[model samples]
Target: MVMFAIIPYLALSAALDPLAPIIAGQLHMSAQTMSLGSGLGNAAYALGTVLAVQLGLHLPQRRMLLAYAALLVVGSVLTAVAQNAAMFIAGHTVQGLATSMLLIAAVPPLAIGYPRERLHTTVMIMNMGIFGAVALGPFIGGLQADADAWRPLFWIVTAVAVLALLLVVLTFEDAPPANPDAPRDLPAIALAAAGSLAAFLGASELTSHSFLDVEVIAPLLGGLALIAGLIVYQYRAAQPLLMVREMLTSAIPVAGVVTALFAAAASVSATALTASVLSETYGPVRVGLLFLPELGGAVIAAGVFGLVIARRSLHYLPLVGMILLAAGILVFRLGMPDSQPLALLGSALTGLALGATVAPALFVAGFSLPSASLPRVFAVVELLRAVAAFMIAPIFAHFAATVTGDLNEGTNIALWIGLGLALAGAALGVTIYALSGARPQTPDLDTFLAGQRPAWYSPPLLSRLRRSHDLDDLDVALPVPESVD
Candidate 1:
């Protein structure tokens, strides 16, 4: 159910790259409209993370999960049978919102509900379901495009959504609200929704307008400012909706967040940008075929995640993933779209990088906090991850198109930046670990599941600078939020 519900939408997100033109032509829509619709969809996805957390705090768990799935089905149907732009955009936006909501509502339980022995399986499923689908999307899109048909793929996604909904019903179990007493935090919700929507909206405008144009820059900067304001507010609020302060103040969680964000931002060159360049030379089918190796890489990473999930080595997974990601970027730079071997190798490595980095970083963050706070912790990390990953693509795309007046030259230049992001992320995470004197220690999943303590020790920021001999005064742990004051 988790895999089915999640894969269709995420796959569709990437699949849209090739399907967009066919969609635009059939719907009698302009390029800008398609861009606008996609922008809104991305916004829903990014904002829905925070919204899911909020709902979890106050709603019936399983009941809401079912609702989210049903909503997803409706959205999928709308897109599948759409006759106009409004229907398609509305459905796409809902699919985005419902997918994230389903993710937050469904995944944490799978992570913490089972025994330690079973968590390895959960990690593998989650990694494959979330990231693997993304890895497979281009091939699926290319097939549909080569067929010169988009409805078939959309129908398939709708069918998957329906299956997911049925799975929800068969597996239903009643559960109470997580914490009814938690603050409403309407302000946080407003800020998150507005910031994500405006930011993506502005970025999407780049398809039709220059970066400096008011349509692109005004809302872009404003949305970013609002997101900054949201973080400050959440960090300072007496009873916040999310665990902003705790994650930011702890060395492990902070490192995890940095690793996740940077890996996501850097991996774009191997996927969307390269696909764009390839599309100019090869037809959709061939382009998708060349990138088919990405799915294999993702599968390997997923298997590796299952093996290391219970071990202390999980902490280093993202670092290794960063190294792989950098190698992949370097390969792409060797001559993406032109060098078939490098493109194949680069796609494989990038698939590995993405699957390895984000999932492990998320778990590392979860392990740094108590198990009960996993949803909130995931919400925060994912929100930032979505922003860094989704928003950076368009900006990079624009840069690649205009910088050298040569598409290939400009794309190679962008690959250089992606390489920097990967390295910088690795360096920052390593630096934080060093500064905090944090070691890669084994996590006690049993203790974490009991909500008794975090799986592993996460020292406060700058612990190396402040600790005494053997850290006598630092014995006490900072309190994590469970309910509103």
Candidate 2:
């Protein structure tokens, strides 16, 4: 059910790049219009994370899940049959909104609600469902473009959405609000909506305008500022919607988050910019074929993650992923846009790198916090990730296209920057572990599942470097441990 629910949207997100031209032409839409639709849809996705968390706190979660799935069906149907730009945009926007809502509603319970023995399987399935779909996207996109048709793929997507809705019906169970007494954070929701809209709006304009143009720069900067403001607002709120303060002040969670953000930002550019260059020399189908190994790599990574989820080795997974990511960038750089073998190998490695990094880092972060707080923790991590990955991809693509007169040269430059980010994220992660005196410990799932404490012990950030005399000042920075009744 989760697989069907998530795969269609994610795969299509990847495929959309290839299909955009055809769809735009057939619908009498301009490039700018298509870009705006995509951008707004992504903004809705980003905003939906916060809204989902808030709604879950005070509403009947299962009922809301049903509603979200139904809306997804409506969105998919509208998109599959759209004749005008407005219909397409509206449908896509709704799809994004509903997908994120379902994500928050579904994923965490599967993470925490299950028994200890099933944790690995649950995580592996989740990993494969999400990243595997993403890895498979380019190939699907390429196939659709090669056929010179977009509606067929969308119709297929609509079928999958329908399947997801039916599964929701079959799996329905009664569940009450998560915490009826939790305060409604309307300000946080507003900030998320505004920030996401502004940032994505600015980024989408890159399809036509310069980065510094008023149409692009003003909203982009304003959105960024708002995002920053959101972090601050959440950190200080009396009852925060997400676990910003808890994760930030802890060493492991901080390290995990940094790796996740940079890994996500770097990984998207790996495929997009390189694929753009590849498109110059190869047809859509051939380029897609070259990238097919990406999906295989993602599956392998999912298996490996399953093996290590409950072990001390999970702590090292993100670090190892970063190394693989850098090596993948090197592969793409050596061959640039021309070597078919290099494209095959580089895409696989990058697929592995991405599969290994983001989800594991999220779990690492989740394990550091109380089990009960996992959902809220996830909401914040995903919110940041959506911003970093989605926003950075367009910016990086634009930079690669415009930074140099030669497209190949510009792509090489972007690949190097990606390599740097991967290495830097790894370095920062290691430094945090060393400075905070964090050690890899097997997660205590028994206590963690009881919601009494974290799966592993995480030190306060920089606490090891502080003198014993100053310990009192940092005590307030520590999370008050939760206890299960």
Candidate 3:
């Protein structure tokens, strides 16, 4: 199950490497326009996540996997055979939807099938595959683009999808459905989706345009406001979109979110840096060869973290990995020579960091959620990471382009950013470890509910929602309100 999930992530990211150049040269399009293809695809994918929650209600998990895999195959085939750039972009847009569906389908098996003790470790191992593919995909796809044609890479990805489909059918079995009596908060769900979209769109715009620009600020602010409102509404409502009470009151979940941000930024920075350096410095093919060591490292990290590590405190491993990441990036940026062996070692070190951190961070995050909440939790974090990778990477490129007026200089600048992000992540990891060791008593969901009612509950809707749960009911959950005193 783990290996199958890993394959889809690997295959999807492979095309991301060849996409920009292929669109530019083949389509005769400008960089800005080609970038839109990525933005649109990402937005579609984000929206698809909300749809996944509903779809899970109606469909069998294994069947959903098969259907979504078929879509990926179709999308890949379309991309492989595309003659014009429009056709190619369309293919990717569909691919985004298909991949989102695949991601949603995979979550249940991971969440329900695995034991809680192994959950974090399993997730971390899976993430290593994900980041490994992401780190290495660009190099390989870029090489193929240089050596032959970019189109064939799509066919290769399609083959992998077929394999994943077979694996799903063979290994996955559906669990009992959620009780129909459980309250459905459609309004909250819609708000959550809208807020997520606005935030992502806004964040993506932050790099390309001014924060004050109408296109950017309106969406960003609107998104933040909407998400805040969703939390407020969910806090008092009968049921919630994200089970906010459980998330807020638990130190584990809070720690999970922090770890996710740090780990995601650290690992993603490497891929973005590689894209800038390899595409400009060595040509795509040599860059592909350069990443081989990184791929090997990722495989090793996945196995060691996933299969061998038994410690619940394994969250600290990523902190160690962050230190290694900082050292590796510094070494690579400062020590790159003409020698192939030297370059390979630098790449290997970078890969090792990615392998070590990516999975472990994801494991910790997902471990804090119940099975039913896994998709929503994973979607938010994964989507945030994706947005960060796409939007922020270009910022580094743009900074390099603006300041040094040289691609190589720009890559070095990006490396510095990568190093800073890694160090920051390490700091956060240390804080979380210290906090966990302190063993501060967490407030129970029911205790938080028993606090005196605020004036806002005078409103009919809010008041009605609040009445649904008993003030002293031990099991009642409560999300943090938008404004908490």
Candidate 4:
């Protein structure tokens, strides 16, 4: 189930990236136009999460998985045979949507259904499924790109989708919906889809139009407004599509979401920018080689995550990850090196940061909520993350192409901004840890969400200040708002 759900997306992502230049040239499209397809595809991925949750409410899980896999096969076929930009974009968009639907539908069960002793195995699987595939993407794409061919890669993906369909049929099970009678949230779905499409369209426009262009600004602002409206509506809905109120009121979940959002944005933007700059100076193959270290880093992170989970030190893992990410971003800030060795090192560090942080943050959020609430939680987090990570890439890419009319200069500017975001994410992780009074080895998810300080916790700075002011005798417990159980 895991391989069926994850491998195709990773393979497709890997193939598309290195082959992008060749694909663009062959199809008579500009880089920005190509980016539009990727942007929309990712937007579909984000919106599909909502649809998956809604469908899961009304359909048999295994049947739905089969349907999604079948659609993926169709999508891959479209991409493989595409002869024009429009056809390619349409196919890739379908691929993205199906992948996300499969993801939200499949992964939560794997996370929660397994035995407690095997939770680490689940984490390792997730790490490998996601980051591991991403790490391998460049090598596969580079080979195809170096040969100046893309159809073969798409054909390969089509075969994998077919394999996934077979797996779904063979492994079919009869798991009931979480809420068989749950009403479809059409309004929420429409709003989410419209918002994601508009936002991505707006960002894609930046590639050809200035940031202030009406084509760019209106849809972007309108998209954000619609999303804000969705949040307000969800907060007040009788039976919300997502647990907005609960997430808003919980400390750990909020922290986890923020960490995931910023980390994704920073990491993805950096990779896109660096790849564009370096790939131009060096051929696609060398650029792909530069990122091979990411695969190594992801493997290392999976091992580290296994150790952390075994020791019940999940709470501190994000902090460690953010620190590494900050250091990695700083490496890029120094320069986007033409040197292969330097570029390899930078990619490895950043990949390690991504593997260490994003998945662990997700686990933190998952554990913080009850198993029953995970679908909604995962849906909302994936929605926001897709927006932040995928949408931001085109915008950053656009600026990198146009900022000073020098790609290298534009890339440096983007890297500096990415560095700032990484540092800010690290700072936020620290604040969440300190304010929540979470410990390194803590295993109680509820305690963190409830904002209950561990027995050994003391507000180090606050306590010292209080003693200095002779106010240490007064009670100083931080208040935690009541959250949905």
Q: Using lDDT, give the best candidate's number.
A: 2
Using Cα atoms with residue i matched to residue i, what is each candidate's TM-score against the true structure? 0.95, 0.96, 0.77, 0.89
Model 1, span 148-208: residue lDDT tens? 8999999999999999999999999999999988888899999999999999999999998
- Tens digits of per-residue lDDT for model 2, 1-485: 77788788888898898899999999999999999999988999999999999999999999999998998999999999999999999999999999988889988887888899998998888898799889889899999999999999999999999999999999999799999999989999999999999999999999999889999999999998998899999999878998999999999999999999999888876898999999999999998888899999899999999999999999999999999999999999998869999989999999899889999999999999998888788889889999998899889988998998788999999999999999999999999998899999999998998899999999999777764547766787789899989
Q: Give the TM-score of candidate 3.
A: 0.77
In order, candidate lDDTs are 0.91, 0.91, 0.60, 0.78
210-253 in candidate 3: lDDT tens per residue? 55678777886897687678657855766554555555444455
- The count of backbone overlaps in candidate 4 is 0
Assess candidate 3 and give its lDDT.
0.60
Q: Summing lDDT over every window of 10 consecutive residues in candidate 1, give the lowest-scoring window.
A: 469-478
Candidate 4 residue-wise lDDT at 37 = 91
Clashing pairs in 3: 124-359
Q: Sorted by lDDT, highest first, which candidate order results?
A: 2, 1, 4, 3
For residues 59-111, write the lDDT of model 4, one tens digit per residue: 88878888898888888888889999999999999999999998888887776
C-alpha displacement of 184 in model 1, angstroms?
A: 1.0
- Ordered list by TM-score, greatest first: 2, 1, 4, 3
Misplaced by over 4 Å in model 2 are 468-485
| TM-score for candidate 1 | 0.95
